[model samples]
Target: MALNPPSPTPSMFRKKKSSSSLGPMSTAASYLSAVRAADARARARGDTPLTTPALSLSSSVTTSSEDTILDEGEESYSDILTYPSIPPTSEQVYTTVHSEFGHCSNEEYRAVSQHPAGKPVAPHVEQDPPYYVLFTTYISYIILILFGHLRDFSRKYFNPGEFKHLVPHDGYAPITSDFDSFYTRRLKGRMDDCFSYPVTGVAGRTIVLLERESKDSNRTFAPTGRKVRTLNISSYNYLGFAQARGGCADAVEECIKRYGVSACGTRVEGGSLDLHSQAEGLVANFVGQEDALLCSMGFATNSTIIPALVGKGCLVISDELNHASIRFGVRVSGANVRMFKHNDMKDLEDLLKEVISQGQPKTHRPWKKILLIVEGLFSMEGTMTNLPSILELKKKYKFYLFVDEAHSIGALGPHGRGVSDYFGVNPRSIDILMGTFTKSFGAAGGYISGSRVIVDRLRVRSHSHTYAEAMTPPVLTQVIASMASIMGVTPALPTSTSTGTITKSRMPEPEVPEAYPGRALSSSLPTWMDLPPAMREGTEGRDRLRRLVFNSRYLFRGLKKLGFIVYGHDDSPIIPLLIFNPGKMSMFHRLMRQYSTPIVVVVVAYPATPLVTSRVRFCVSASHTKEDIDTVLRASDYVGDVLDLKHSDGERWPLERIMNSAVELVQMEQPSHD
Candidate 1:
């Protein structure tokens, strides 16, 4: 119009405000023409044409030369297009370009360029074109190569053939060589199988709150949202101290404040604190030993210390029913180990005599030392060791004796001094006195007490002493406080005794009162029966032990009267009820849950015991009242009858009934013969 300026370039026209007023097809045509022209210009400048595809436009949309110029009536086109619009800053341009290529941000591209593996950008090159475009393209190619290799590797190795051997094969190897295979195949669906239940609340002698197993679970037992509260008769809270709150808890809290929790390192490093030494001294004095060494765990005390004490030239004769810790310890000791029948003094003596006569293996040389290891109380069988008989054999054979008082300590004897005090055998007769604080002490860790030489040697030689972290301050303090309560006096200094032959003293049975009719009070008395009457009258350790014995007898009698076959001694707190049939065992467990008054008891079976010899075990505590014991007894009788677990009137097991009948008939015939 008024000598109009040369028409604006197509690129400028594409950005004009009038372009927004165009139809969709016209707008597409304009964009396509602008992109084509830009590519042509780039090619004319000796650069590669833009590789990005141009926008496609419909054939009906057309643009003429007249459309490129604006009319004078529309005002100056340059005035509108050349207005001072803000230009994008470097950060804004980088962000916009990065987003177009699916990159997270420009910072990410810069980070890659700085990497040692990435290509360096030349100073002459622009920042946007080189760093982001090149690095992203390089990363994508590398990822594709890696994915190709991964696919190839998966095809070659992760195939069915790789795992074919795990299935059954017609080979010489037995199908069930180990427990894992055996449990997988044979015992797969037996849901109520023993030893997997998770208990809640206090695992005390009487009451326990536990989550019930869900009936819907198939592969494994799972706890339900609902909880069952019942009388607990399965725990090993021997002296009712597992949940002690008064003194034990107080002592632990005080030490926690002072030490601030863990010892932080191994005993040989920074873990050994003043509390550890004081606790060790207390344990040694209580056990009447010259010195004692403490370890963080009860089981490791035996498992590790045994190897440190003896080697290949030595012989270790172990009790068949000794704790698993002792069995494992003997295996690790590298000594010639021999096992005698459980609690059989004659079998032990014969084995000892034979080994002594035979001497060492192969070379037939005399053994460097012979060690006898036994437990003060057998946990599984609920029986105490024949300490007097074992001591006599040790004397004649000239062997060292190791006593594990895990169950008996703080639970047996007049002063809770363990088997030596229970049987009136001198403590000096035992070479090594090993006991745990877990059971009756209501604490964690174990102590190995003996002569100064043995204790010092173990501290230096035992791997646990050098490497394992020392017992935590709180646990050590708990043990110290609980032990003080049990002893009824402060922990005194250990006194040295002559190693000369100790005179044996037999424990006399307590005189039963004639007031109670048709009952021998001595039959229900505990090992603390020999405690002084003055001490027994008080609410001391002896009274607590006596209450435990009374509860045990009550439960034992109730089970027997209900026609249930019970195991263990009358005065023993652990009571076992036989349920030989696996089906009946599972049924008994279920029925107990369903009973009006539900009761919780432990069921022991295969692996823990021999196959088909599953039994329901009950542990009576001083905490258990007569009402609690009665409730469990009544529930057991009902469940036993419902499951047909009770023995028939004339049907004793293993030919006992037939043998008795034959004896009666022979006696009648004898009268006719006379």
Candidate 2:
């Protein structure tokens, strides 16, 4: 039901009007007389005046001083009542009337101000006015009061119960559970404590950093602003190119000098410069694509381009574990979407066969198009997609494929050409090739590399290309320089295939040791010396890739031996330490910080991963040394034991058993060529 204004009481009309008042006047004059009468009545009741001198309407009213003078020689109507020669504009009249009278008590105004001018007005009148103007004003004030009450009711009663848990009792609080509440209340005190550890210098062999704890008194371990030299493992500086002194940095400096900072607008507008074109060309050449289009942000490239390619009437078959950006894009596209289990070819095939047989939902007609989307590497799980299997399914289903290689671009494959190269699949088999320059490239944008037709279409139709600001000149040049380094064309760097061979002394230990009490404490020798010669021998880029693999394997093996359940493949740089219990997860993170050799790792919890499987994700970078890996392993071993996280038979799982299991996994993942 619609709320109404309260009816006025009879006592409100009992007040009398003043003597020497002017008779009924024009609308503007009536308003002014009402305000003056209300002000006088308020003073009689010992209440504060409605309008102070600070809010005087005299500046806008333009009343002459002579209008107030009483003539002693002749008492005439002309001398008593004075009106302006020119009527004030409606805006001016409203402003002056409201400024002087808006704050007056409505009840008091109804008693005295509503009385007829020039008459000795009383609070109680036998007859009422005939005009509807005053009645409409009362209704508006009533509506405003009702709106205020409704707003308070919604805040107090309509908001979700979860939101109240995070907010204070009285002051303004969030009425909904959103990103802020999720971070501040649910994950901030625990997960944020581990991520974004403040570092004083470059993420090198040994990083000078600060660690945070999840305590009230000392939430951060390094509260004194002191930095500790600890093993660096949290970054994605793959290929060891992020900290290059003279290569990419020099090119970026030169580019900045040639073209100031930013492109200033969208590519089609004034923002497109020669450097942008050069970078695009270099990226296309590096990735073996006919053309490439750059966007200001890597996340935006996928989110914007996917919608442009397909929309309603289209079907998007996606991996269950695809990045959030891809999910956002598919949602924006308004496409009918179906997700298959992560890396499960059999499940994907079954779903595809069912969809093909049934046709589009609700309509027994063929879909306009079908798009298959998957990531080159699942960042959270550190598992590579079975591209060969997916390609075979794509061939059978006749669907276009989109691969987001944000993590695999410069870190995967023998020559670092991404997943297609790593798996020996032809790049042309995939319909869309998307990657970001932020990770291995150490730049600030992303690119979409595909056929000439696709590139041309995106240039004109993609919302990001049409509306967003172009990539800045410095970031473009940085990407170009990194691509050159990876391609072995930079004079300052060694060629890709021209590095020294691995020495026999650097070979890894062939046998896994038995469980011992002092295994972690006994490791004084550097662990890099024990890496396989195959890992140590290669060109600079290949060597870094091998080191990344070696470190990942070493860390995974050590964690398994320590009895902590880990996730992902051994070859993948991403290793997730699974801590299923939320309270245990928080405790594990806190203990990791307090370890003698403190290390920073990314913690993924609810909304990112399932609530039941919260984990600490470690990204093994090539820049990490063998000693650095061992330090973190020792710390994990000690903490895992303290928290009773180790399995009873963890140490009994020997190297041979681990290798056999990996072989079985590979055989299961491989597609039959027959």
Candidate 3:
């Protein structure tokens, strides 16, 4: 009668396990009272000595091995995930597999997510690597280019057959110009192994990667028929909502049972569902917006919606490092575009002033409107946009502000409401709030939230809404459940461990009044969505937010203390450690994967980042335990020394010492030598 995972089905997803002993879903002996009876039995039987849920309940990716249940009698594996340093006592209980969700009971590990009152938000610092590392990185690319040219030279003479694609036949244009693909053939082609490795199962705390090998230098690959399980630190699974089980998953499963897989057509073409409205309403509430609309795809949410906001006569001032989708949309919109240095408020103000003073290019006529676009959290650099400063600029310049919170929503803020919540500013101050559910909600699609007028306008004008498929019922359910968990629900039910109502205000001082939107009400969720006690009370959601911040700070600061050049704000869930040398990107990845406890990492080089600043980005999740962070720190320390990547000018801490003083390190102001 418990909510354990069902046995695996031939299909990708398995249905939730139901015991034969329990009454039927449709009460055999009652009327509309069927649902009430089922729910009553569920809630009453769920009453237990444990107050808090053993597993974290945020959005997440997949279940481990078809959501495997923890067998109390089975002997634990030697793996760190299975047999953690401090195993749970026999008296304690667990509902999750250790590989999927690391067990951490130490409440002391938690930290609140909020800026100190009256103090300025900490500025993002980019620690530069050693000059020699930069030189070598350039040399590595130069050597690859030289070899590529030499290969082309030899092939043209001795192996002319392979060069036919670049030569025109019968007056038809060649397949593609050789020069057009020079970078891909010369540079990226060599290290395709480190990128896009095949993976399976839930992308939770751990991920299962399918093994493949290539003999012709990554031109093609053949599966080795082997699967490797590795510690997952590369997914956008902030808050660990990328789960295949727990409240979120259960809700999704129920949704699939009631509502089929697809929405059948585009939103405007008779494809919208009641769940669409439900999700839109919850999303609007979550981001503190008046109303919101959903796009079937995250990329389209920006690429399609931006065109509806601005056109030929308008001006778009965007962060230079803004996502490509934004640039594409701006170009398509035919808007006059201006670029500003990433997250640099001074550069932004200068650009804004120049655009205002200059007016429309050449015509010297005033622009119809000016729109400034910035990401709430930079995915690669992990820099939080200067919201407070931008709001001040918004007041002075009177430009429409559109913040893309694709990476920040449900991952930042004390309440997990996103950047506006994180920065202690009113969400409505900004003209538009755009976010995607993929990052933190562990679901697909995106949303654009703002005043009702703006949202209603986009629905009619945006290409995605008019053409693309509406979001499916399952994804919408995941969004609603995960978001509700984060916002918390009303008509609370007390738990065995409950000690009065939970306080969400984590401000250092009490008198300052709440600076962000408050919790969600019961009416915000659907009448059918029945969340467990912990999620109902917002306890699990609160725990996940605190856990994420703790891990984020620990990883960012820990790498710096290990004498590595780590980029981004310490509170950022996305932590990038500089790899510098392009060649070592593959080496670092392979070495980490080959560790005693295999760790999967994502490596980025030129194009995504500067050539000299190639880095391995580690996305922290609440699913990770404190010990898991220690494991990553230890792995990086060993790998850094081997690859000579530790080049920052800082007091380096010993690996053992770093592991021992983690809680102290997370609590301290980052970059402090102590």
Candidate 4:
């Protein structure tokens, strides 16, 4: 039951413009030809790598990508990792390693990430599980609570000394009520083994996880002096830039050798490095903004900059599911905060109307400003903010918009711009564009981009800029190198735009599609930094985006076809496969890790998600191969069958069918409801 590619209609999405050769539509061959070739490959295969390889191997076995490398002496031929199921034709040459970045050369495996022309974007649909699954999930929590209270009740009477911290100890009042830490002591303590497991090495396609064991009910952990390389879908290395060996890494090393580590003082003080200005300029260009300001830490970008943007008399309308950092910033801003249901435009509009009409609470005085704050892509739920609808509302309400693209920047849209680019909205329309480097750029820090006036105001008023250390040289270099890779080197043409922030360059740029996001100008990068040819030409960046989308959609659809409840749009790299039952969440994690390939996963429960919808979030990476996705699907299928987790509404496909039909499956466009 593959979805049909919905036809284009008139609305928000504009007609397909001439595609930019920079990324999305640029393939080895024409898309029509690639599709035909892929369809033939799928149909003509007789004995070509039957289904998925064995996945439930010993935990002692190495990761999937390394299976070929480790067993080189034992077998000379390729394994599941090297070339996946289909062997590469003699003509193909792969320069990247199968482990660091999976070897995917399929021209048919890519799709334009923009919304369909003239079609309105669809909001996310939250799938429900069976009533019994809900009952068991609730029951498990109830049982755990009962046992916790009973144990606490017994401990109080028998071992009163254990309650010293809860009681008034010595002189100071009790540190905290026993009730305050009840959940931590009881629930989180039991499952503490799953959280914060230590790891070493690059968190690329495969992460080297340190083996540790805690005997005393998760009280403490001691590493077993063992490192296990597992298929990594846990880290936020969205575009697979987190490499210890790359041109970007080399640039970072060069920067460190020259500038050393620390930024020393705040940007407002003496700590300002020339790299900061360069990175800020490139970032502004990348996002199509007039100017940009950088912050040393990702969390601080919002917490510090938001306070500078709005204060006392302003109103901040936030999506209820906004990240905690945003909440922290809003509170510090001293603005009147109101929340609407997540991604519900009608709800947001209704709330806005009520607030704008009511004005300031007591005096009914006109408000200084109203800011609509939303995350470009929510991390936990994986739902994208309805940017198109919100933009339409922005025209009428006249509220300044602040989009937190922490997870979306460089991970969404065809040009890797963000949600605005994904929805075909001009980036300038949004008042402020905020994002972090930790996710996509494989660097440390965040940035806020906007008009020159606003950025200049923030440089003086923002706490992170004035108090926090300026962005370090190495991080800035990594950002520059990686971002430059995606942008390619823009050509020289003394042509300047009205913004006057444009820089002249000597290097030639690719023929960017008219609709493509603005590329980072060559002059924006430090002249000292050197990059590999693929990156300089923007081919690697394009491949990463293509692989990421393909992997994301493959995993998402594969999970759905396997009858598992999933949240988020398919194009989004963050895929949350619902596991619902509390106990099942832990079991699912352990089973996936202990499987043949040793897939390390992140299982999220309660506070992060609604209590009943506890899930395992698979952050698909450009590093993962199509075979890697199939491996995940196979593992999930096994675990789901064991735990009775496959209750999602859908047409179920056996794991083998899904594996063989990956290319056809990826090209299947989602049907439009309208």
lDDT of each: 0.57, 0.58, 0.76, 0.77
**555, model 4: CA deviation in Å?**
0.5
TM-score of each candidate? 0.62, 0.62, 0.83, 0.84
Model 2 regions more than 4 Å off: 1-174, 178-192, 195-197, 204-206, 210-223, 262-271, 490-539, 648-674
- State the TM-score for model 2: 0.62
Q: How accurate is candidate 4 locally (lDDT)?
A: 0.77
What's the lDDT of the predicted structure labeled candidate 3? 0.76
Error of 4 at 103 (Å): 1.7
Q: What is the lDDT of candidate 2?
A: 0.58
Compare candidates 1 and 4 on TM-score and give the better one: 4
Span of 10 residues, lowest total lDDT, candidate 3: 20-29
lDDT tens string, model 1, 493-589?
2444556775545454343322201112222222112222222232334445655655665665556556666655444567777776655666677
For candidate 4, write residues 1-674 as lDDT tens digits.
21221221111111112231112222222322333344346445432332222222233433333222212211211232233334333222221233455545456666556777688866677878889988888999999999999999999899989878888867979898776678888987887877898886778877768788988888899877766767888989999999765678778877887876554333536646789888987888888888899988999999999899899999999999999999999999999999999899889999989999999999889889999999998998888888889999999999999999999999988889999888788899999999999999999999999999999999899988887877778888999999988888764455544556776454454433222365566667777776766677787787788778888888888899999889888888888988887778888888777766778999998788888889999999887767678778877887888888888886988888998898888788785310
Candidate 3 vs. truth: CA RMSD?
10.1
